[model samples]
Structure formats: C-alpha cells, structure tokens
Target: MTHRVSELTVAESAWCKSSYSSGEGGECVEVATCAAAVLVRDSKRPTEARLCFAPEAWAGFLQMTTGH
Candidate 1:
C-alpha cells in the first residue's frame, strides 16, 4: 500500500540526500522515512510525484541493490 507523499505529509517529512551523491549534484534522489513507509523523490524536481515503498519492500530493494 505504497503511495506518494501528500501535501499534508510532505509538510512533516524530513528528506535526506543519498550519501553517495556527488558534490556537483548532476542528478540524485532524496529519501524520507515515515512510520510505515519510505518515500523517494528526485532532488531536482521535488514537487513532482514521488515513489513510495513499504518497509519490507524497501529492505528487499536495498538488499538486492547492495548485493548483500
């Protein structure tokens, strides 16, 4: 049941850029964690739609991406 961060929720979110992001900042993503979901959005266009993931799905994605 993942969904984009609504205007109301966005007001309460604390987004953080990826640590691996370059200082030049060509393109990167930002993430915010909520009580039951993980929110991801492009740093360049934050006002655009975001991609949300359930906690379990997010953990699985990290595992696959990190090859851990």
Candidate 2:
C-alpha cells in the first residue's frame, strides 16, 4: 500500500523537518510515521519524489546521516 506522506493523518504521524535543513529553500526534507514504516519527502518538490523505509532502516539512516 503506497501512501503519500501528505495523505497521512498528521495527528497520528509525527511530521518533522530535518535538522540538517535550515532556512535554505533549495534543500528541504520531511519525515513522518506510518505505523509500520517511515515516510520521507522533499519539501521543495513535494510531488516529485518520496521514499519509505522500515523502522530499523530509518534508524540506521538517521544514525548515518546524523553521524551519531
């Protein structure tokens, strides 16, 4: 079931903007929850691209990206 992040219920899914992204307009990234998976999308071209990952993968990605 491919679900768009925008279509997700914000109340249930905690949406967050990447700390890496600042006031810069060119770079924009957002993430939200979907019970079983994590949803990611670009705020710049929201409709252009999006990706999903499992809980473990998302955690790994965060660790890698954040250098933690």
Candidate 3:
C-alpha cells in the first residue's frame, strides 16, 4: 500500500533519517510512523513519492534486513 507523501498529512517532525545513513548525503533514507502505516522516503527528495507499508510488513522487512 505504498503512496506518495503528498497523499498523507505527515508532520515534518515525524520524519527521521535511517541510523545507517551517512551525513555525507549518499543513500539517505527517512522513515515516519503513524497509527496505520510506516512511511519511507528519500531524505534528499522528500517531496517525491514515498512508500507506505503495513506495520506487520514493515516488521518483516526489518527482520529480513537485520538477518534476525
């Protein structure tokens, strides 16, 4: 259920950069969580389309990425 950021009312303060993101600006990613979904966007282009994921699906993605 991915969607563009323009479709949601996410606050500016809700966005956080990925812990692994380097301050140098390469591969920067940001995530914002709400009651219904987790939002993912490119930190460098926040006005662009964003990806939305169900909470459960987001958990699975984290688990797979962490290999745990």
Question: Number of the top candidate by TM-score?
Answer: 3
- Global lDDT for candidate 2? 0.72
Q: List the residue pairs that clash in candidate 3.
A: none
Per-candidate TM equals 0.80, 0.65, 0.84
Residues 1-68 of candidate 1 have per-residue lDDT tens digits of 54545732644349898898896967999888888788888988988888888889999999999999
- In candidate 3, stretches whose alpha carbon ends up further than 4 angstroms from where it belongs are 1-6
Q: Tell me the tens digit of each residue's lDDT in model 2 across 1-68.
A: 55554565544246677777767576878887768678787877666656877778999987998899
Per-residue lDDT tens digits for candidate 3, residues 1-68, read 66555566779999999999879878988999987789999998998889888889999999999998
Q: Order the candidate numbers by TM-score, best to worst.
A: 3, 1, 2
Residue-level error in angstroms, candidate 2, position 12 = 9.9
TM-score of 2: 0.65
Q: Candidate 3: global Cα-lDDT?
A: 0.86
Q: Local error of candidate 3 at 22, Å? A: 1.5
| Poorly placed runs, candidate 1 (over 4 Å) | 1-4, 7-13
Which candidate ranks first by lDDT, i.e. highest?
3
Report residue 15 deviation for candidate 1 (angstroms): 0.7
lDDT at residue 13 of model 3 (Cα atoms): 98
lDDT of 3 at 10: 79
